[model samples]
Target: MSHSFDPIDNQSNNEHFQEVLDKAFSNPSRRSILRGGLGLASMFALPMLPGCGGTSTASDAAVGAITELKFTTVAKSLADRIWVPAGYTVKILHATGDTLKTGVAAYSNAGTDDAESWANRVGDQHDGTEIFYIGSNGKSKGSYSYAAGDKAVLAVNNESSAEAHFFHPTGQTSGAAVGKKFDQFGQWTLGVRPAAEAIKEILMHGVTLVEVNLDASGKPTGYNATSALNRRITPETPMTVTGPAAELANLKAMMVTKFDPTGNTTRGTLNNCGTGITPWGTLITCEENWATYFTMPAGATVPTDTKLIASRTRYGVQTTATSATAATSRTQGWHTVTDADPTSRFARWNVSASGATAAADFRNEPQTFGYNVEIDPANVNSMPAKRTSMGRFAHEAAVCSIPVVGKPLAFYMGCDSRNEYIYKFVSTKTWDAADIGGGIAAGDKYLNEGKLYAAKFNDTGQGEWLELSINNALIKAAAFGFTSQAEVLVHTRIAADAAGATKMDRPEWGAVNHANGEVYFALTNNNASNRTPGKTDAANPRAYKDNDGIGRDGNPHGHIIRFKETNSMAEATTFAWDIFLFGAEEDAPAVNTNISGLTAANSFSSPDGLWFSKSTGICWIQTDDGAFTDETNCMLVAAVPGTVGDGGAFTVSNTMTVAGAPQTANQNTFVGKVLGESRLRRFLVGPKGAEVTGITETPDGKAIFVGIQHPAEEATAYNDVSKGVWPTNANNGVGGTYGLGGRARSATIIITKDDGGRIGL
Candidate 1:
């Protein structure tokens, strides 16, 4: 169970946008659109100007639209199996409980796989993966290197686990018999679970590294977990902290445990979502939605310090609850320990003021999390580090642009929350080809020292990247004054707010079009309560009800927004912007619902994971949805995306209720690109109840990997497998009775052309 949704930080972007909208729109038509707040349809009324930050005539050539989609679109399906184009073949490479070492017994395909084996096995909820080519001669390029090889090392993130019941026969009884407890969501309720169960689940929440080999025919045949390169970074793995905040006095004051009195080291990484590879041969694994996993101990008083209180409040940490026996809000009941020392590892889950000072308790435990963790995939023994300079709030993905010869590298990131701001980090060090194999050392050079920036999009087709540096005048005068640079990075959302960053609609994954130096992000839906008419802005413009019957509104179908930095430079503060794609049902009217002209082959909702393939220049869009689930399972779509100003401009009439007041429908114009099935086609629909995410391909685009997450998540109990069983029956048809027999588990599958040709060609 992830943390409950919190909108505290979202208000900053809205407040800032309101100020900008007040100054930009002067005409009556513009005022009507600005009155309720600009919907996406009204923001992109002009195509992005090339070379500089100004409007230009919209055109397919201006946006750099790709030629066409190559393969036939796979039809949408609610099947209990994977669906792909006719010639594409998919094979299960690894799934939950698969061995990572030679001596481990084969997974029994039953829930009986011992809790102890989970650490040495592939984990649950696989997401954000990468494949590192290992040549037949055992030689390879740097960590960021991509190539074709008969052998490769694959890394997959196990985001989280299902209920304890899924691991046993008697459900909670099996757990309680071993002194386990569960939360309302049926996940382990207490912070302290049965030792065996706790260890298993904790170990499952990190990354799985394994080596895979292809047969003579070039098809992936088998994988070996016993390979020397195979390794797992569990929640218990020790890691060093780096960046501005690592050595802060306040941070040190917050640490008292044996793990790190200096506050420069911490254990484990959680909620690892989208990932990135660096030019220096390393993996950038993001820690997202981590704040919800912590809780305040019962009876703990909220801190008295204004800054501490404000920071905690904004990050969604419980500070006002007075309950003495239960947590105010916690993702996992990791705080409900049984018999353990108050200062023990389990005690760290409850971040309460229980001791004389910050260092005497676990009040600062969460501060160590929510960062982009860097790992050297080539060096299995290398320790991961929390790159704190990347600015921590709820990180989605860290997509870096192509490194220029002498220019500083830039990384684009999104904070995965309602109306959070998009961010960028520019390395202080310029790029050098010699550092290709530098690994963590290179990370130390480029990642440790950089400028973090937040974006502010003006309604008049322009945007600026505001520096979050303490030297900036606006941040310096913030109500929650920052005492150090580390403070600004740690409480990044607040700093971004003070810097006047634009709030987005649940910003999730981001991708950089390395070809044209353009960036795209998935603004995955917001509800009416948070995105009321008055709350919409240029970047997050839509606020209308959908036919999903979920009763949710405010860009429920979401859209993909793209922009180009001036001079095609990553460090440039100004950029041109436009709406690249709007998610909608095919048959929906051409109002706000089907603005992108999506046809039957490509209509989708709640766009989440996004990746731009360097090999083929195709932007792959994956869905994690509920609004359109009644018609189709989550899917993966391949798109030959156009650049910034492809579609020119458009408008729609929409009725919305402002911050508590009802407003009549009004017409608004927005600049956006139009894509049909020819350019954007659904390539795959996942098993029922599974979200399509984590996509990557070989250098030649011959072997592609996609993550299947949370299969059969709707099943009520351990024995209720009738709801949906995937992978095991992925080749079988829909309905309660399908293929092989087993429970559902998140796994990564390999997709290849049956003809052994390049995929998406």
Candidate 2:
């Protein structure tokens, strides 16, 4: 709900402040006197006078007048460094294993940190983050950057991890079977060891909250370790379901208590990727790739919940051990850790059915995850609630609008898998200002009482929103056997399939344009398996392969799609749509590679992060990919986007030009491309082996923050130095052979102009 903070609403007051300051500085005589006094007085003394050398009043005016802005220039280019503009500075405000509570030592970075310390430190793989300014009264200002009497609380998602060696002192290989031996460790095989390791690994994943402060320069300066807002939520934390599942008494009992309830609220939030800030001022972290953390033991009896099994498969959870790969087998084996007992935390991670009844087996564990987890970052004592009304799937990101007083609120989301559809949840209840700081109570009103719909992009450049209601004929008749609305929401993919909702190419993130009320999503590359020969549709046209070992029938690289509400109402069912840009090589065919005049510098693959600046109209694009790393790592681009259908119609066909051979029409045709610098331009590049994802900005437009994930992911053995030492080189400017120094880590960076210029202008 929207709460009014009249004093901070500076539109009227800032003008008055500017008027007086302008009058004092505009006088020519005052300027001369200030310059003269500068030579005699200290730097700080100049600002004490009416027209002295404080940040020029003109600077404040420029920031205030910034109604339109565009991202310009590469901020910083770290060879192994995250890029920002020259005027901006970056600090490691909080790091993985950095204690959030007192009595915990600093992170050793040498794989010696204890689990208790990690439980109190920031979690690993920080992804999506939102800055919530805490007002003096302990309420959230909901502002992006710092304000007077405001203490900032950052709610960040810890996407995923590969720092196995650092998390465990002995390393995963310590007791591992030697040289591919499977049965050397008694009755257990090498594969079985991974299952045990998986349990421990799952405990390490989740969301983290830390309190950060701004320096005199208005940049993130330091983190307060003992801030009441600080917390770490891992898989071990106890969490409860709030919807239909909550009605199941046994399930409710398990949900209400944390794994160690007497000790902590919930274990942690796992596979947390993209997130949303509720109208109530709480954080909604989506659990993605969660199914991958579990395993079904071999020869285990299957549960009767076929619908559940199908749901698991749709989210990429394997039902059979035969489907396991080396990576999948080496998983933390949470199922086998405490296989002797069915009720132990270790056994809960195991999704296999060892007994006939649900109460006696772990088959229900998989269902516990894959739902959205809501956290009250400002209240450490609050237990995270999983709002089932939002529906469940491989949730990539959840984004919401600033709740309008007495108006219905909406949340937009995307299921991050090839061929998945975009979704939205419109609250049934209207917003009330009193609910602003209501936290979970507010969440129960808006998030827990909404209708879910999936997007369908048609061939005519128009899209429709398909509802996933239980009463829908398709859902009722579907093989998944949906018995109720709650069941339909939990098994949303099956319901969507029955409803015939169109599938997309890995819709990673959905961003709502605050300026125009349009929605944009990143379709991060779909493979041939998802596209039939004659089934390629207009919105997802151009299925081809490049010599770069990607996109063989859509193997790699992706594009972004944009659409506007039919009537500017979020509840509208119909809207126009178009491809905003295509990810491709600069030298590739004009039809396939070029979209809106994107060049090599700006061209990138797998667009993952999409955010529109409230202060500036410019759109920021961040990438996550393995396709373009040979040239450079992930990058961020700035775009001046025109609404859907802004570009003229064109066709695209794919063909090889070996020996200058001619191609057929089926191979290529016309498509649209808006040619110009204003359309799209590469703004920044990230450190080696890193993905440029997650972006947010200060409300005043003075600062922008971007996340750099998985730097040096290519390194295999942490002990071996020569593999890949990325962030160390990028951040410290120190380069040497592998493992020479500098260990790679995920981090977030802030960028701004030195002259106090508005960002993205």
Candidate 3:
């Protein structure tokens, strides 16, 4: 992402913040969403595709019985290949356009596949991921298994067509206008997107499920593409809206379209990103950056409704009749495409008013997204449900508190933008271990009713949750209008704004500690305006130039924030907080930028994907970066974490000369003890032009599944291969003349240990 931006590109005064093809082959050729969550006002300024080496952070200290990462630390590399410790191995499980049905042919990777072929193929730009094991025998027949098993179903979120050009014969009319993002929608100038192309895009997003085989060996092999459970839940899939707001007139009225006049159901999920696994063996895939998909016809009039306008502005939803620069203002023209279908599937992308009634046009289409959609990966016949009770915004991920036998459950979430807020939903129904195999029905019983709240952190290492509901007096009489809870859920950003929630940096993925249930979130980098002067609060304090003297400003490297719930209880409204880690270049000034005493062995930037291994209590951190791509591609690192208050306070100074006048300000922030080599170390480095995200491990922690998204995004044309060559480079090294014509596909990879020992052990 970039350091500065015109207000028009982001207007972020406050708020926030792939590729493929398949043939998932090593193309001797091409490679490139820094996608959907392009908040109207806040998007990560991705650098245009496309390394380094390291030692192990010391593993001397132990947190309880949880030991440290034991593999020879992976060296930070720019080899254009996936690099792991010497004892580990990486396997390409599947890639974009890979066939899911046995009869389908392997992808040509030359962009020649017919539109219909995608229905039976893997979707592009994989994001969030989860696995559900199946019973080994009739004794556990027809039921999902939580324990280790041979047969398991995998659910992966195909976020966006980060490199849609690979889907066409020639290049599509698209360009990367912001940072280094894939920008599939940014450079498009098409007046009427072709129906065939449009349909491919429609089917490319949402989630993918397939059965896989796990072995007694340390590494799990590949998937069963022809398994009866293999399926794709794309935009055309039908789903019901559930939760507190589902029955309210506001949501129903706003959700009504010709396809579903009653507004009880909607079609498809988009921009699926982070994920959460319910204790009941189901997947909760979050919808991030779903707003930009529905744009008003270029040069249309803005909406006149005060509430509507406020909600659009707050959520960064493109509004009616707005003026945006060339290509930047338009999407691929999904609304302009014409088709024979009666439901106006092609025309539904338009959110502009054109008809007399709510059911007349696709004016309300945008309201239907921005919530977490639940899927039962093991049951292909079951319908997915959108959990509307989890107030919508640009949702990144949902990390649940460790389930207590009878205590209430809490799902922590982030808005994923500058100045946005972190939120959580407390279920009305407490945890019940009996619901372990309950699937979607279990989702209905627990997630359907909850009290939502936004987080507020004080400078003194303390924080509290502010309720967001009509029941709250502040929301009841707010100037935004006193409406039903449906309006509150739908316009959550506005509700949080009214509640005085703390503005964070771009909040991304969050993970809860298995040891003590402490919550940790990744505030993945920010620019100057978003973290403006005198706005450095304790939770997000640093603002400085990078160590390379590259002139990069703001908190470019990002940091991880952690907290302990009051009394270590999930239902606590107040908590203690501190910075668990401040990502840096390892050589920055220790007093400020490198406060955690980072070393080359464990330095990283833009901490976007984060998770804690439940089996071992070790923390896993992944990067999706634009700030540090020059020296290395994105990567995954492992660390042993300390408690929230273990860190000491440090004074950070930020100096910037305004119009030739030098000025400086300082802020004191608390942080955890430096991890050094023992507690923290690099684990895996991915291929060039790809993001390292979406990770999960098998029950015994012997194997890990990770998503390598949109590699070789540096290419400018459809057939450009010189910029990226991967998957092909995966097993060996870089191929001739750029993959020797191999295509770069966003793929799911499995990592295992050579000795059949637990991974990273």
Runs of candidate 2 exceeding 4 Å displacement:
1-72, 75-78, 144-146, 178-200, 216-218, 244-268, 321-330, 338-343, 531-535, 549-555, 656-675, 730-741
C-alpha lDDT of residue 105 in model 3: 76
Ranking by lDDT: 3, 1, 2
The better-scoring model by lDDT among 1 and 2 is 1
CA lDDT of each prediction against the hidden true structure: 0.70, 0.59, 0.70
Total clashes for model 3: 47
Tens-place lDDT per residue, model 1, 18-133, is 23443443333443222211122322233332211111122112233335677889888887888888887777777777888878877765555676677788877888987665
The C-alpha TM-scores of every prediction are 0.88, 0.82, 0.88
lDDT of 2 by residue, 456-497 (tens): 655444668889988889778877787778677667777777
Candidate 1 minimal-lDDT segment of 10 residues: 51-60
The 10-residue segment with the lowest total lDDT in model 3: 48-57
Error of 1 at 597 (Å): 1.1
- What are the RMSD figures for all models against the true structure? 5.7, 13.7, 10.3
